[model samples]
Target: MGALALLAGCGLPRSGPTRGEIFNGSVLREGDAFVLVVTDRVNAIASVAPALGFSSEFRDAGLVGSDIISPGDVLGLTIWENVSDGLLVPTGQNATVLEEVQVDGQGFIYVPYAGRIRAAGNTPERVRQIITDRLGDQTPDPQVQVRRVAGDGATVSVVGAVGAQGIYAIERPTRTLSQMLARAGGVAVDPEIARVTVTRGGHTGSVWFEDLYEPGHDIALRNNDRVIVEADTRAFTAIGATGAQSRVNFESQSISAIEAIAQVGGLNPSLADPEGVFVLRNEPEEIAEQLTGQDLVGTQRIVYLLDLTRPNGLFFARDFAVRDGDTIYVTEAPFTRINKAVSALTGTLGGVNAVSSAAQQIAGN
Candidate 1:
């Protein structure tokens, strides 16, 4: 009875989850709130992906036409008339020069004979036509020319992690995003880990520098657009039985779980349980709903399980997208903890034997 009681009392150490027990099919069936997935190449990639769509920020950047003028733009006007002693247009002088007429806060420019003309929101060419029409009868065949000298409205400010940081004027009708970055003295951060942000009209959007390598990603820039280039803060943590338990910054925006694991020095071969590979992430409510077939309220902290012992495990790992702030954990093998406990017990027993032997020798003396 005593022996049976001893065995029964030490039935199990309900400490933490064992290697076999965690991330298994049974966990999903147990009606646990957390989501567990058997990662497949197709589904793994689909799981971490947020519904990505083309940005509307630079939609009009592709539009070909004259650059539109805005408030705070400096305009230079030159007027010429055939008749002598003209009121607004000088005949004796080559042209009546109105150098640096800054566009007002109300988006209007003061012309000598044309009164306050709506110059903002219209191209320089459009403004010239409006002014010429207004002063047609007053001056004989009035020839007007409009030029942009210096203006905050016709320029963009490039700030953060750049060689040169200042307002860059759009001298030409259109400047591509790449061209603007080059003019601003290129990006300071590694191109792979850099993120470019554009803010305009109270709306903002960002894209990784790696995206610029694509054909159409190098979109054009508009007047008064604020472009910021900064180092990417997105990172993932590798913990547990992995070779290195540290935070790893993404070199590129999208990296497969396989690449991430490799970058962190693949799992500890001796200690890691191949079946216990897991990724913990706070999944968005929408994603949780799609995975579990139920609407998840608030932040759904989901744990994704990957069985690397399976045949297609490597392929799944390659396809799985590791997201920012994700925790990649490779649980220790069952035997590893048991071996450690045994070693501690052996060391304790050896110390006790050495003490007993020394005491026996002293008693004999």
Candidate 2:
């Protein structure tokens, strides 16, 4: 029995004290709910201050305001003349007044009478005024109008774990980040909420989904902007005597080992060795070896064992957070494994006898 217990312990996972686990136990034991310390390094970036901007306090950058018009936008212009019968007439002999104009690569639109006029970066009303002024000498009371035709100039690219991934044209000038996501068909049906990354010119910025959804925290989209919705790459594998031995996606930045087990529907009570729960983590050297394919000298594998038999262990379970791709395994009790082995041996013998009898009958026939 002693030898069996030793084998069970060795086979079981190893658990060690974590920084947060130690801190929690120490601080809570002192009966202090609040603790403050002045340090040069602060975690202010994760916290968001709505009054200032939509960006988190920890983020060095601010939220993008609104999208502006750029060059190469197709604009539709129509000139109408008030006629005698309250009907608008085209100034041209063809009786066609409306003319669709394209803003050139240099942000200039050409009119019939007026030469190349710059319309890009100007509002519709501003463009209309500029057109009116330019054609003042040609016709009396020249009424010019300008409207956006093609939206190629103002576009946002949506990529990553969304239903649709591509560059979307922003019909409206003032398009928000949330609206752009909706146009991209939303995020995947996973715990990982979509992260929006906006790249403009050569500068890039990122914002979390929660920040965009929460009230008073709205980020604007810009023209010629690129929004990449990256897929959730991090995952946690739950194995051993769990209800479901599967890999659960690590959506949040942090997750406890117990929570990871619960994600797979917890451990199988009948076969689980509560005292032998273990978490297998790849050491830094192992990860480096796997990544670079070079043999790492003195590489050590890390295995954390947790004994869930004690009530105090529950506190550690909450504090011991698991990293992405970490494996959570609840080992089967020694007795259970023995029983399974015996059953497998018996089943194998019975199957062999049945096969042998069938072979003999065939040979006799």
Candidate 3:
């Protein structure tokens, strides 16, 4: 008993929050700042949900043709005059050979009789009309054909962790973000855990690869749009009496607390306190009071308690969003500690009794 008492009192205490302290609602400290916000599903989602905000480059704009031309593109122009004595061509020549014309920096292409026409910001068909209209006065009803020789001006760049990384020309009528990704051989990592970012004009938005298949996810790509697929390294740490205590990477974009608990090996039946499943997180100081009643001063470490003993606790765990860098802890139950102490005492007494019995037998012998 004495040895057990000494053993229990000595050594270091458990390096984690207790069930009682967290259930009572308290603030965890770190350095000299208040950052934790332990709360229920409503508060937790509100506090950390904003980080998931991704502004999409493709908004409600429906699918659009990718035939919009830009400067530096090469255009093939062929002019055909029905009359044998064409004014634009020679007296005997009825057609002009295909002319390879490069759209200048000013978005203009020069033609023999059409003069310099705006072709950079217009589609190939639109440029053909412009050339035909210009040559109408020179030649009687000139039939003009404009073909895109090379796609050097308008292209979508696919960079980052993908099988094929390069600029893909958007020559189709409607080129979608998914099409560009497919052109790049999809993402190198798993689609569920990968993040795809689309930058168009001045707006940029990101979505998980799993969301790429969702409705409205296959947005149309614009000229000069950049699609970057990056590996998702976001993760959360699980400690205490869970199944396994270690950092677990986010297999998906987001996971519920119930799934997170299962990933950490679930609660340890022998040592976990059913009423003290806690999630520790750091939140913005502005919404601290609204989240929890605890008057947190520094390191606003919030300890959210989930009582698995209650009927609604397990149900609500599914709604809780496990944020990145969150700490999922299952505190040790009170009886668990008592059992350890009692087992030590029982072993010590059993050894003493065995020795005494051996001595008595030896004396009799």
Candidate 4:
């Protein structure tokens, strides 16, 4: 019987989350800062703050900056004149100057009578002051007002195996990358963290979600930006005496052998040959060819193996992460295969004897 057929006979159910869940959960709660820092040794700018309970007005303390601006933003402006009632009244019957006016490609907004005004790099209050100064001669004591239509235009892309994979818009001016991910829905049940790429201006960049929980390692976002959450579609082939021997979907870019086994509910306790377990990967020649063609090898296209019986194997199990398109084979013990063959032969001999005896009795009658 084929490996798949053998697996079907075992009646194994679906697999669930394992240690990978802890990493993914951490990413959703904190961010990708720590993971990046550990893997690449890069420094992040933002710091993680304690969660403020039941305080709606308190913004995430991680957000820092005196006055910063981004592109593709909108603003609302209201001009008022002092009134006898002590409440600010509209300068004219129509007090609103601009409503939801978008910033231009050059990061400038065209104001009425004020001509082209730079708004991209300036704060809302500063922009209002600039406009007020420009119109000082036209009105006597003109009170100007300005506010962001959409604040802190940092965005992160969500691609791959997700319910919704695309660019998610973030309105928090000081929100970190980790905060942006929560806004985009946490990683799917089977997440490939290594395959998760963060690109800036069409160039590849890295973010450390783990560091977000640490003191200082969170990075801020910019407007018109993108965050792609992609599902790692890599296929991992499982062979040998496992419960279900078939190709399992690896949601993340890297998966250790132990984790892979757990994903398939570990080796079937009754049938698995723990000592002979092996993972067959692409040959070095094959990898070199694939990489030369498109540079898709290296971390993204490597495979590994694990032996559960060895005590020290656990260390390698965690460190030897699997790459996309990896194959894991668990060889059955010699006795198991021999026993199956002997049982089949015995059953065949019994069936033949019964047929011969029945034929002779019919002929004699």
| Count of backbone clashes, every candidate in sequence | 0, 8, 12, 34
By lDDT rank, best first, the candidates go: 1, 3, 2, 4
TM-score of 1: 0.81
The ten-residue window of minimal lDDT in model 1 covers: 7-16
After superposition, the stretches of candidate 3 with alpha carbons farther than 4 Å from their true spots are 1-13, 20-57, 80-92, 112-115, 137-140, 159-165, 182-191, 285-289, 293-300, 335-365
CA lDDT for candidate 4? 0.54
For model 1, the local distance difference test gives 0.75
Model 3 residue 27 lDDT? 24
Top-lDDT structure, candidate number: 1
Q: Write the per-residue lDDT of candidate 2 for residues 1-365, one digit (tens) a residue.
A: 45444443343342232323323433235422211121112112111121222344324333333333468767777765444321334434323354557777887877776778777666677778887786666555667667777655566788887778888766553377778787778776452445567776776666666566777556656667777766545788887788888878876756776788888888787878777676655456544344335577554344555667766666556566677667776767657755555555567689999999999999999
Report, for every candidate in turn, its global Cα lDDT versus the true structure.
Answer: 0.75, 0.61, 0.74, 0.54
Tell me, what's the RMSD of every candidate? Answer: 4.4, 11.7, 5.5, 13.7
TM-scores, one per candidate: 0.81, 0.52, 0.73, 0.51
**Stretches of candidate 4 exceeding 4 Å from the true structure:** 1-105, 111-114, 128-174, 179-211, 215-217, 227-235, 246-256, 262-272, 283-320
The CA root-mean-square deviation of candidate 2, after full C-alpha superposition on the true structure, stands at: 11.7
Per-residue CA lDDT of model 1 for 1-365, tens digit only, reads 45434432343332335545453424356534474655563364345565222376575555423467889888999988777788775556757898889999989999987899998878889999998898887877889999988764467899998889999776563376777888888899888778888887777777776677577677777777899999988899998778788999988868877888898889888778888888877777777676666666876767777778888887777778888888888887776666555555667689999999999999999
**Of 2 and 4, the candidate ranking higher by lDDT:** 2
